[model samples]
Target: MDGGQAMIALGIGLTSAVDGAAIAALVRRALAHAGLEASVLAVPDWRADLPAVAAAARLLGLPVAPVSRAAMQTVEAAVATRAPESLARYGVGSVAEAAALVAAGRGARLLVARLAEAGATCAVAEGEGP
Candidate 1:
């Protein structure tokens, strides 16, 4: 699946989450482990963090999506990894997983659960394409 399309959710905040070193590194680590490529990044709060989010997308050579709190919330039940902090703060289990699902659009499903290190996380999801 090296060339196949996939949606990747990235933890994106300056201090809150990031397109930071740890999280960005995990994007490759997680996708490589799962045999996927990064075609899109589902940044959960890209609207409020546009520049960083855009920079991350440009750096990764992929598109970035804005995943709203409500959109992520819609996929809470679909996440495999549960972060207590995320649950309390965002009403979702895993921000990465939820963002991935939301970015993947309707009929999306998680292809990989949340992967974390250094307070950052990543997840992958795919949709039933047209």
Candidate 2:
């Protein structure tokens, strides 16, 4: 999943005021577990969530991409993991998976499904290019 034109997109979901270190660690573990390198990191475009997501991106030396709630909703049906709480609050089953799919765009597919640790979740998606 590295060494080519294959790009990995990461989507993150966080609880309020979660620490950047926790987010970074979880994302690192998820990437290593999947044996994939991320090209970009993404998060929902909610104002309160941006800081931690941005910090994680900086920690990983990757740019942060924001996916709107509407765009995330469109990919919810395709997400394999369903979190009832997230579905009730965000109108999506899994924020990490849906956001990754949306951020990666139309033909993107999940390379790693949602994985949670320390009040944060991370997922990876690969674009259908190269």
Candidate 3:
């Protein structure tokens, strides 16, 4: 795709709604700095929420792989069992960690969604979520 036509997706992880909003603002600024103008999508937990992330990416006009709801639920259950405390303690670093977890195969993708829904600070780095 042409540089002008290429689209980007931004995901953010936040503890509160305010944090999500702030992250969105920061993302917009960063995009401006990079001369890119894409949208943002929130993902409560990036690591455990691959299904929702894929859905958001598709909504942003990007290609996506097929993910089953049952599989995503399994992922959620695994992560919830391991990290019962909260993601708020993890902070911004969780983003990279979550991606790494997804890259690995210890669990599924709903982990991120659960974190964010639980009030973890998570959103697409660019595009919006479904």
Candidate 4:
């Protein structure tokens, strides 16, 4: 499939209620750096406050994919970066990385690892689409 046909999932982790503009800016930069367009925004299901992420996805015209904590944990072993605090609190070393991988489905690989800005984090994962 062509590059346009490929889907890239963006996983976001937030510590606070960030503004949609901030999240969108970060996602845009991260995606530009990776030379990929995001097909969807993925967030941890346990996170109740998701207005920022939801708004960002709407701003970017992409769908939101809520990944379960179990699914995110399952991909933790494959994550390259390790966040001790995150692991202690959420049982996942890198929530963004893990969430991206899980939301992208099987065989998905990280296109851009966690990129942090203020209270938010972003990661991108690429997967094949049928």
Candidate 5:
């Protein structure tokens, strides 16, 4: 996704019943795993948060989905000064490291890390960290 795009994903539970804070944490972790820095938008349902969530994803640097379009555009514009090359070394990683990556704005790296952790077959670039 471009820096101006939104990245949307499915939320596993209802905010009213599942706890928005907890789900946000999970979503953050998942985005980090995917080498993307993002947060769960505070909306009534996943549908409502789609835009915000997408914006968060773009801020962290990832491909935005339809639902995340609106929010992604906002964040992308906000973080325009940032660089995509920040996530040079990407692969599976722990939540702790992923959190650090997100904080550092290495969303793309976190996305790759999450995908690797999720069991997606990946080929690490030469001379890259594990």
Candidate 6:
């Protein structure tokens, strides 16, 4: 437990609202802000489908969590941002938060609340693993 666990297994959630470059930067910031070692992040399966998300994952070596909608719904309450559109469509405030929580898995907790920047939104969650 040196340095209080250098690396944190963090997760992210996003949509097509962002481009590849921005996604990459968002991902980078998430890792850097966590101040972890050999940083790694996980995104929901749907986010992986986004060209920008895929590109970011490739650029940062981020893992794409094979999460299901049922799983994501389980963490809908944990989300911080409350958007009317997202609530009506996904039953969650932010897809990013839902996905981040799902990726983190059981006992998952928010490390960084949802952040909307550069036309994209993301949230960071920490759990047992990606």
Off by over 4 Å in 5: 1-12, 39-130
Worst 10 residues of 4 by lDDT: 1-10
Cα error, candidate 4, residue 25 (Å)? 0.7
Q: What does the lDDT read for residue 69 in candidate 5?
A: 27
Q: In model 4, which residue pairs have backbone atoms overlapping below 3 Å? A: none
* lDDT by residue for model 3 (78-107), tens: 232234343344432344223222322332
Give one digit per residue, the lDDT tens place, for model 1 in 1-130. Answer: 2365544444332335444445567777877887877667777774446554566566677766777899889888888887798899889888888888887766778888877776566788877431
Q: Rank the candidates by TM-score, best first.
A: 4, 2, 1, 6, 3, 5
> By summed lDDT, which 10 consecutive residues of candidate 2 come out lowest?
1-10
Candidate 6 lDDT, tens digit per residue, 30-116?
Answer: 657766433455566666678776677677776656566677778877877888987887677877777777766556777777776
- Work out how many backbone clashes candidate 3 has: 38
TM-score of 6: 0.77
- The most accurate candidate by lDDT is 2
lDDT head-to-head 2 vs 4, winner: 2
Candidate 4's TM-score: 0.90
lDDT of every predicted structure (CA atoms) = 0.69, 0.83, 0.35, 0.82, 0.30, 0.66
Q: What are the runs in model 2 whose C-alpha is more than 4 Å off? A: 1-4, 47-49
User: What lDDT does model 1 reach?
Assistant: 0.69
- Cα lDDT tens digits, model 5, 83-118, are 233223222122222322322232323222222222
**RMSDs, each prediction?**
3.7, 2.7, 10.4, 2.2, 14.6, 3.2
Q: TM-score per candidate, in order?
A: 0.79, 0.89, 0.33, 0.90, 0.26, 0.77
* Tens-place lDDT digits, model 4, residues 1-130: 3444666889888865688888889899899999887888888886635677768877999877888888888888778779999999888888888888887775788989999997888999987632
Cα RMSD for candidate 5?
A: 14.6
Q: Which sequence of candidate numbers ranks them by lDDT, best first?
A: 2, 4, 1, 6, 3, 5
